[model samples]
Target: MNRLDIIQALMGQKNLKNYLEIGVENGHIFFRIKSTFKIAVDPKFIFDATRRFGKSIINPYNLNNQYFEKTSDDFFAQDAQRVFSAKKLQLALIDGMHEYQFALRDVENVLDYMDDNGVIIMHDCNPQTAGAAGCFNDWEVGEWNGDVWRTIIHLRSQRPDLNVFVLDFDQGLGIITKNKPESTLLFSPEQIKELTYNELVQNREQWLNLKSADYFYNYFDLQRP
Candidate 1:
């Protein structure tokens, strides 16, 4: 399944109201979401802003579309409370920096502000090629997954109590929930940083929790009250 499919499936199962998306490149996924109160955070949003989603969906607080043209860190530091405004953050998508620490921090930040039943979707957890899963900031544009997968490994290792799994589709979409927030960091960010694409390839069996897309739906269904 693609990212849209996964999101659509989850949307079907949950009544999402407030949504936050980081890294809205062209508003492909950003505008598609029908959440009542929506926040899109991107350092640079490259979509045609005039274009509309063609739906008159109402939000909890009647707020209009909120877009922050800043990094996720800055967006959270300055506007997180304003964005949620005492309303629980129900859904958040982290498709930001694509780096391990950045992704990890994004997850952490979302968890800190999320509702008890909130869900976080992280993109690029499964890289199909070394070219796409590189550790370097400078990568050849062909399908770069960056080091986001490391964030999954780090989360699994550090927060085993959290409900986390990686969908084996759309280059590895990760679902994280079951709030067990903590102040722990990976023992050594450098150790995870030092890992190369080759090392990841060699250690994939040990680091990734690869799961079928159906598994996610089934798991979510079971979690439903």
Candidate 2:
């Protein structure tokens, strides 16, 4: 599905109250989501302030909207605990850093704030492919390095309890649901090392076609296990 369709589906959900977006370039997604409270973080506040990137036209009417001038890593490492202490986040979108370590850290930090049934949507989980090459045009301004994809893989290995699904469309969006706490048995230490190493060597095209929802459902039936 496209971004609009995904946004519509999320808006239709009744449980969403608080929403957080890690990368708010122009508030496109922020403006789309209807929620009681919404928070957007980005270190390039000056850039956004200038509205040079064509994000200035976004309506400035949402009372619950809040924009923070902070890097994703800084927000995750220091501010997330305090910000989430009083609020129950029902939805979060991680489109900030596309690097492997940064994406992994973003997920680790946001998981603490997510409600039991809350869902986290990640952008650019699938790498660029010949057929899907044009999809990356929507990305803000950096090169796609498949960091988000690697992060999702690491999360699946480290946290077996999450109901993780990769949306094959829209430049590869990843949906991960937190259910319960459990032992980390899916990924071993050796596996993590191997995967990380392999990620560095894997071509973008290969990464983009690694697996899709159908593949997971037919092969692993991850939802059941």
| Best candidate according to lDDT | 1
Residue 24 lDDT, candidate 2, scale 0-100: 78
Clashes in candidate 1: how many?
A: 2
Quote the positional error of residue 82 for candidate 2 in Å: 3.5
Please, what is the TM-score per model? 0.85, 0.70
Candidate 2 per-residue lDDT, tens place, 166-204, comes to 677777777777754222235553565455434434643
Report the lDDT tens digits of candidate 1 across residue range 9-75: 6666777667888998887887777666788899988865345333223222323678899999998
- lDDT (Cα, 0-100) at 205 in candidate 1: 44
